[model samples]
Target chain A: MSHIRIDNLTKVYMGRRSRPRNIHDPEEHFGDNILVLNDITLGFEEGEMVCILGPSGCGKSTLLRIIAGFEPPTNGTVRVGGQVVSAPSDQSIFVFQQGGLFPWMTVYENVGLGLRHIRDAATKHERIQEYVEMVELEAFEDYYPHQLSGGMQRRVELARALAVNPDLLIMDEPFSGLDFLTHMKMREEVVNMHEFLRKTTLVVTHDIDDALIMGDRIVVLSGRPSAVKLMHALNFPRPRDFEKNPGLSRLRSEIFLMLGVPYAV
Target chain B: MKQHNDGEPTMKDNPEQAPDSGNRSLRLGLLSLLVIILLWEVLARGTGWSVHIFPDPLTVVFSFVELLRDGTLLRHTVASLFRVTAGFYLAVCLGVPIGIVLGRSVNARSLFNPIIQFLRPISPLAWIPLAMLWFGIGDPPAIFLIFLASFFPMVVSTTIAVQNINPTYFQVAANFRFSYQETLTRLILPAIIPDVVTALRMTVTIAWLVVVAAEMIAVQSGLGYLILDARNALRMDYVMNGMIVIGVIGLLLDNIMKRLGDVESSKWGIQAR
Candidate 1:
């Protein structure tokens, strides 16, 4: 069964006028109305890891936000677990690009923030510790976000989301800021977590390699007023090692070709 | 690699070269104070001004000691401190929650903003007559004046702080399925603590100013009253002495509030400096 469904999503951004005229006409001063997402329709199956890939301003993040219920669509419906999403729901957690850990909170506290709503203290503690240990962040639990490196902060954010045990995890370019080595290490950690948790996930990224490495299925989105260009179901097996995986390079080239960007060896 | 217990890098591996930075700041501060005092002493001795008009720092210190010996200074200081504390606490208790509500709710803010703006421009001293008329020249009137002085700024600053918080924090709270009250208590309150602390420090200073001004008009037993009495008697030395006392006490109270704010902010890792 499909765990998440997005149908006919449309978002139009109305721009304001630069100057006011003596006669007021509502449409005259509406400088330029740009459509960001045009009738985007897609679905993800239960326990599947899906990546939405496109260039910047391709509305990939906008579509993810719609699915997360962070933003309302101009026209469409988003269903999670067979229920319509009107606003941000507890069933899905969205991880942002910049590792949005609250700077004021210690890492343990940051990870535990979502669990504060859980009335059962024992369960909250167990859940927090479980995810913290999963992310290998148990030692840095007391450190503040400012004290952590970008990669570590992202790990904390991931742990925070996982601790909530949501039905779906949504990530928007979660590893774009990290150095190459750190990004690779984080990818491995995420893959490991996904395999263990088996929770449905949707990730949006511009990096084709990341799409190939992390996604179970890749959905390429076309530029502004976006729509899905292609959806490829990867046949890579579990515990797949990136260094040893031959299909990654082939898939990367295919994605590059689909995106109409020059393919690099 | 020098690592923290958390396996992160630490600054301890390479010793900081400017190890004497703390000592340097302390020495410079003390030197500045000494220079100011020396200049004051020279002006007092060299000018044709009467010692009564502008007493040397030493004379002021001597008079301070004499007042201390007589216990009048302590009594007045305590009385002023008590008034300021009572008024400030009342303002905070009433102001912060009202501010938070106003900040969070647009209707509440719109309703109260006009009245607050109307009242804010009126000086604390201007409230003296009404306070006297309402409470009849006692501690109540004095405290009321101070409350009028401190409440608006505290409430305004707090409201602004709560309103201006990063929307991302609110989104996070909502994503976590927090109840509205839970969002306010757990996320919003903690996020605004730094701003609240800053406003609180400002409130204390304003309260100090208001209490002194209130004492001059509404009370017969505070530091301000001592200054008024000295002036009435034409004892300029005692007047200078009372002014000095007010200055020193105000500085001490401000320092204490600042240190308390520092401690509170540090716990949240949001310390200003």
Candidate 2:
């Protein structure tokens, strides 16, 4: 049974000054709409981890937004758990490219934000502590977002998202600029957290290794006006260590060729 | 420029956080005060100026002691404190919400900015004659002037704070299904505190300054009245004492505000702002 379904989704962006916003400005009415995503129909089952792999300017993030209910597609409908998603809901959480941690809140407060709705302070506190410790930020619970390293801030974001106990976690390049070591550590953390929670997760990333490390299934997307070009299931085992895996490079090249980029390394 | 901060690790060697910085500042301030008094004493003695005109530091000290003994200083201080407190509190109550509302709507801000700009520059003192006619002489007119002084900055800073908020915050808030009340009290208020508290110090200073001017004209029985009455009687030392009291009180109030802001900011980690 599909938990999320997108049927023939299409997004067209109006260029700046290219078109009038309303019919009142008839003289300024221009008809130049740039197509970003075309016929993007995809679905995933319960507890499945899916990664959408695409290059820059390919609108993968836009597609994630459409699923997160932050954006509306010009065509096609999206359903989450048999219900159409027209607006953002507590059932789905989106982690932005930026960590988006509230600067004025301590790590504990940031993580505990949504848990207040749980209606029991003791239970909420326990859940917050659980998620914060899961991300290895137990020591910095009282510290604010600015006091932590960039990676730690991202963990706070992750912790906050998880605290809500959402059914769907939509990530858009959540680890864009971290050093490789932190990236690997965080990826492992995400994998472990997913295993622990078994939430349906969808991550959109341009980094090929990001897709390979945590994704159960990878959906490749082409450039602008992008549609799914390929979908591959890894034959490798769970939590495979890509640093030592010999089979990873061949898959990387395959994706590169599909993306029309010259293979490097 | 915005010094009312969480007092973070700006000084690398002192990783002990707030206690060290606050102590050092207090020590430095006391030393500077002693040095200034010594300079005044020497200059008054060296110049051989008249006691009535250039009353020495000792005279000011003696006059302050005398006022303290008679209990007039307490009465005047309480009167002034009451006016400024009522006025500033009212301003905060009125200004912050209005600013947040205007901040949410850009069209509203643009529409109102010209009116705000026009009214902002008109000195609160300029309203005294009108305030006197409306509220009459005593605490009301002085409080009104102080209110005018503090309200504008609070509104302006809060508006800017709301206007400049990152859009991601709202998206996250939406994701969590927060109520309007939750978004304001938890997210919006905390987000604006750093900016709002910085302006808080400025508004307090302006309020204190206007209270003196308003008291000198529109009201009676305050430090301002003390200064004016002493001058009329040619009691130069008493006038000097009143000036000293105003300066010291202003410094004390400002320190109290900065300390309050620092304490609140530290809870949320000040450096991030």
Candidate 3:
């Protein structure tokens, strides 16, 4: 049995107001209804780092949101460890794209949110400090989210999420608004953290190279009324380099072609 | 020459210039006040208008001293302060929580918003007759009028503030398993503090405005009564004294309320606005 199983997931947004106008397929639009995801079945193994890639606005986030239990699927079910996922729980934490850290709370307080259940003060403080240090933000424990840079804010959010020791960590377009260098650094940090923790991590991204470099298994999703386009396990060793490795280079070109891009380079 | 002037003060000199600019503004403000007093003195003495109708600044200052010496000013000011405090506190206690409820729950907003909107436009002064009839002329009636003046604005502003809070924070709160009480205390309250402070500042001003009006009709021992009493006695200087005191106190209240938005936890909300 998989650690997380998304079985035959189908999400159709109903009602006039609920229907999004960003539908790529006009054929799928019925009156006051639009289909988002269609019969998508996938499973994530325990401690597996899965990167989901798709075209922009291709319902990748909807799928991730469903898995994290932020939104319900119109049909089909998402189960985690034999339990059906229904509502957002501390067992699975979702890190938003950006600016999710409470503006009013300092980094220490934000990270301590998960540890709020612990009655012992010293233990809670220790847990907060441990996660803060994990993200290399020990010097900024007292700083508020708005005081930090974009990358540092993301780090604080990451620390806040990881502090809970959730069984599954889901990130949606985590590096979208960051600068080039900051984005690469954050990507490296996430990969390193996943390597150390080996938690069931699902990352939704648009960058193919990011999926190739970070994912233990990479799943590509197609456009609206999305279904699984490809799911391949990347057994390529760590420090994967497309330039140095011919196989990775070939796979990158294949994925680019699969996504309808003419050439990789 | 301009380049040389700029070159003299590099980054090292910028900090020194900040306080210099502040001191300059303070001096200019005082000078402006002096000019206004001078203009008023010239107009009062040269216009040949009845001194009874428009007393000179010197005469008003003398009356101000007399009122202070007799403690009449203190007593009246205290009385007015008491009514405003009682009514404003009552409104805040009830209005803020109701506002949060309306902001959070669609059902509560739907049920209450129309009634609030209908009542909000009707002036607090319009309630003067009803308030006198109900509470019958004293601190109760005056305070009731002030409460009416401040309550609707407090509720409306707070509701807007809470509704404007980022929906992402609620999602974060749920993801962390924040209990209902924790959500209110840790999320809702802090998120709205800066806005609440601003609402409070404006509402307190309205309450102060109504306090004087309410006192002119309903009560006997406030600054408003002092002005009315002075008017009947044909002592224009005393009336001017009452106006000065009210203006000073209003300024002080505004400054204090402004400081609330500067507090560390609330500053984020202020800056976002």
Candidate 4:
């Protein structure tokens, strides 16, 4: 059995009122209910980094949320290590797309949240320090989320999630709001972290390059009422570069074509 | 030169420029106070009425010293402060928990929201007759009136604050397996502190306003009673002295609440600093 299995997952959001017909999604609405996910069946192997890529509003995050047990699937089941997922738990920690570090808490306090169950104060402090150091945020342990820059806040969140030592790590567009340099750096850090920890990590991203470089395997999802369009394994070695690898370059362009974006560059 | 100074400071320079502008405003504020006092003195003298009817600022000052010397001013001020503190604490203790419940539970909100709204706007002054009937003429009725005046705003503001908390924070709390108690203390309470402090600041003012009125009706020791008793004696200067004390105390209460807002953790998500 796979480490995590999402079988025939479907989500239907009950709308409050009738929405105007979306020209692109003509078949979406049926009596004030919008079909969001249509039969999303996927599996994750232990120690594999899977990147879910899709167009905006494709319900990729919704799928991630379901897998994390933050929301229930309208149909089908997500089983983790042979147990059915019913609610959010420490076994699967989700790093939110937006800044989720508690605004009121210092970085040390936020990271300490994962270790709150530990009875030994010294042990909890040590673990928090370890995670903070892993994120290279030891100097900012006393800083609040709002006091940090966008990239630093993401690091705090990453530290907080990693401090949980979860079996499954799920991130929803974790580096979405970062600047270009910070985005590249965070991508490298996430890939390195995955390599080091070998946790079953799943990330949702809009950037194709991010998927190609960081994912051990990439799952492409189609637009509204989204279904998995393509699933490809990268098997490429670390420090993957489109310039040096013809296969990676071809795959990158292919993704752009599949997403209906011209590979003009 | 003035235009140059005002226009040259860029966004990056705002921190450095803050103190200069703050100093200028303070000077302007003092100038405005002086002008207002001068206008009041002119009006007092021009009225040609006896000091009992329209006392000049000097007579009011003298009466302030006399009231101070006799200790009535201090006694009345302390009385008023005690009532405000008692009533304010009572409202906070009851209102915040109720607000949290209303905010978190849709059922509770639907059940109690309408009743709260209906009671909220009925002036505490209007409740004086009922309060006196229930508690009799003493501190209880006056305190009850202050509680009524402040409670609704506290509940409403706290409820809104809790509701306004980023849903993401609760999800984060859940992901980390935060227990019910931890969620309340660590997540819900701290998240609401900034807004609650602001609500307290506003509610305390409302409470202060009601205490005076409450004292006028149900009690005879607060600044409001002092004002009423002075009016009976036809002592306009004493009335002005009571007004001045009330205003100064009100200003002090607001400043203290503002300091609560400036606490490091509570300033989060509320302001840049």
Candidate 5:
């Protein structure tokens, strides 16, 4: 069943209006503005991992922000589970491109931060430990964000989002900053976590291989003032091994071609 | 992880292996002080300079002992310390919230910015006459001057720190469904803690300066009053003693502030040198 619905959303930013220095000679004013997002509409099913692939300035992040309710659309509406999203909701959590772990907090503290206000302390502690262990950060739980390496901090952020138990997880190029081996490992771990939790996720990225490996369905967006270009459903089974699967490479090539980029191999 | 010794081993050396080196740095520091004292003694006895003009360091030390014995120094030090503490606490209580509000809301900034800017450059010492007229000759006027000195810098620095916080942190807080107050208390305050600590250290120093100046004019009992009294009586030794006491107390307070800043900054993952 579709869990999220985006209906004819539009955003326009009005520039500051200039005034005449001479008050006696006033001229009639016309509205001058920049159109950032044209009308866009899409939907996503529950428990589905959807990748939004687009170019840098394609308004992909803005669209994700609108759905996450960080910013309101100039027109139209975004609904999650039949409720209109006017502001950020606990049901839809956003994972930023940079792991926004609080520098003052240790790995354990950062993961536990959102759950700290819960009246049940024992449950909160257990949940924090479970998520920390799940992310393989048990050894580094006491270390502050700066003390840990970049990849470890990212894992902490992921653990934090997962611990909240949101209905939909929104990721904006979460693994893009990691080194090659770490990136591959992160992809595998994220997929593993998704399968275990069975939570709906929407991922936005520019990497075709990343989309193929992690996405259950891929939505391609065109250039500036982005609109959906194509949607491809993956027929692969759960816990698919990308290294051993030859079909995954073919899908990567198809996505690259669709994005007007030549496939390297 | 490996410890390397490039020079003479000192008190910082590993005590298990180097028992003799453990006290070496302490001994050196003591020896340096003795050398300075001996040089001063030689200059006092040997030079043709007037003994009254630049009294022997021993004379100054003796005057310090005499003031302590008479209990006057203690009373003055306590008075100065009290005024500074009261003023600094007041600044912290009022300045931080105003700063946070201005930093968070554009409307608050627009409303408060002009008034703050107008008052910022007015010297705290210049307020002494007005403070005297309003508060009368006591600790109140002195404290008011100190508060004026410390408040502006603290608020301004805090506002800058809050304004510069990464927006991503706020977004994360909102995604967690945090209320406005929770966001400010949990994320915003913690994020700017290091900067706030720095501002505090700076405020304390400014408060000290202002309090001393205020006490010189508006109050009858303080380190500043002691200096003025000594100058009026033409007892240069007491004046020198008061100045030395002020310098030492200022150093001690600054060190305390430094240690507090280090402790708080380290908690926020900032490495203090």
Candidate 6:
């Protein structure tokens, strides 16, 4: 069994009010089911990093949210470490695209939030310190989220997720709106942290550069009513320069082909 | 000019700006007060107004000095402030937690919204006769009437604030598996503090306003009583003095609340500093 298994997962959001119940079979709506995910099955091996790539509004985030236990699948099962997932647990944490950080909390407080639940006070301070330094926010431990720049806030989110030290880390477009310089720097830090820690990770992003830079394996998802359109194992080494490499260029084109948009560069 | 393009201004970049603005504001306020006083003095003389009807600024000033000398002004002011404080504090204690429930729970909102709407429009002064009958001419009735005046707005503002908080914070709290207490202390409460403080400022003013009216009916030691008593004695100067004192104290109270908001860390965070 894979470390994480999403088996025949299908999600149908009730877009509008349903008709009166007694008139027809309830399953009739299944045909018109605004299917966001369609019987998709995927797996992530332990100690591996996978990036689910697709165009915007392609249900990639919905899939990630489902796997993170934030949403329920209409007809499927998600198994993490051979346990059927029910509710969001401390085993995994989702880092939102917009950095869903607590604005009121100082850096130390936000990073140490997860530890407050488990009541392991002895190592809580030390682990929070370690994660804070890992994300290079040592001097900002007392600052609120609003005081930090966008990039700095996102780093705090990363440190917060890492401080929990979960078996799985899921991120949704973690670098979407960042400037070019900050984007480059953040991607490097993310990959560095992943390499050093080697936790099972899944990232969902539309940006091909982010997928290429951090993904050990990339899964391409199609447009609305999405399914796994393509999956490719990337055998690239650490610090892989996709900007200068022909193989990475070819791989980027492949993703574009899967997304049905032509690769320009 | 150089810092405009960067969009982030530090104290080092704008060394003397804050104090300069504060200084200008103080100068402007003092100038406005002087202009108003001069206008009042001139208008009374120019109109040949009776001193009984419109006490000139000099007469009002003399009345103020007499009140101070007799300790009546201090005692009345303290009594008014105490009533406002008691009522405002009681309103806060009763309103905030209930507001949270009403904001977060549909059932609680359904239960309370109609009752609040009904009680809200009835003026605190309308309760004056009933208050006088029930509490029998003491500080308690005035305080109760002030609390009634303060309660509705505090509840409404706090409920709106809590409801306006982004759903994302709750999701973050859930993501960490936070306990109910943790969610309240760490997430919900902090997010609503700015709104609660703003509500407090509004309610304190309401409480202050109502205490004057309440004191006029049921109490005998506050500025409101002083106004009523002076009017009966036909001491227009003393009545004018009481009005002036109330206005000045209200302004001072507003500034204190403004300072409370200005110095808050949560307030800074809400502005996305």
Best by DockQ: 5
Q: Whose TM-score is higher: candidate 1's or candidate 4's?
A: 4
Candidate 2 vs candidate 4, DockQ winner: 2
Docking class of 4: medium
Q: Candidate 6: misplaced stretches above 4 Å? A: A19-33, A117-122, A243-247, B1-17, B268-273
Model 2, residue B251: what's the lDDT?
92
Write candidate 4's Cα lDDT for A65-145 as tens digits: 999999999999999888899999999999999868898888899999888789999988899999999999988888888
Models, CA RMSD each? 6.6, 5.8, 4.0, 4.0, 5.3, 5.4
Off by over 4 Å in 1: A14-33, A117-123, A237-251, A257-260, A263-265, B1-27, B264-267, B270-273
Candidate 5 clashing pairs?
Answer: none
A1-265, model 2: which lDDT tens digit per residue? 5898989998888766665467654223345566888898887888878889987888998888888888888999999999998999878999978858888778999898878768878888899999898888998998888788989999999989988888899998878888888888888888888888889999998888788878878899988778889888776787576566778767877887887777745
DockQ of 6: 0.50
User: Highest TM-score, which number?
Assistant: 3
Q: Candidate 1 lDDT (Cα, whole model)? A: 0.82
lDDT at A214 for candidate 6? 91
Q: What is the interface RMSD of each candidate, in Å?
A: 2.2, 1.8, 2.0, 2.0, 1.8, 1.9
Model 4 stretches with alpha carbons more than 4 Å out: A17-25, B1-27, B269-273
Model 6, C-alpha of A196: deviation from truth (Å): 1.1
The better candidate by TM-score, 3 or 4, is 3
Best by lDDT: 3
lDDT of 1 by residue, A1-265 (tens): 5778878888877667444443555333334666788787788899989988997887888888888888888898889999998889768998988846777778888899777767988988888888889888888887888778899999999999988789999998988889999998998888888888888999888888788778889899887768788888988876665568777776777778877877565
State every prediction's TM-score relative to the real structure: 0.86, 0.87, 0.94, 0.93, 0.89, 0.91
Please write out the lDDT profile of model 4 over residues B1-273, one tens digit for every residue.
763565455434646777767666665677798999999999988988888898999989888999999999999999988998999899989999999999999999999999999999899999988999999988999889889998899999989999999999999989998899999999999989988999999999999999999999888798999999999999999999999999888989999999999887687644544
Provide the global lDDT of candidate 2 against the true structure.
0.85
Estimate how well candidate 4 is docked, as a DockQ score: 0.56
User: Candidate 1: lDDT of A101?
Assistant: 78
Candidate 3 backbone collisions, by pair: none
Score residue A209 of candidate 5 by CA lDDT: 76
Clashing residue pairs in candidate 2, if any? none
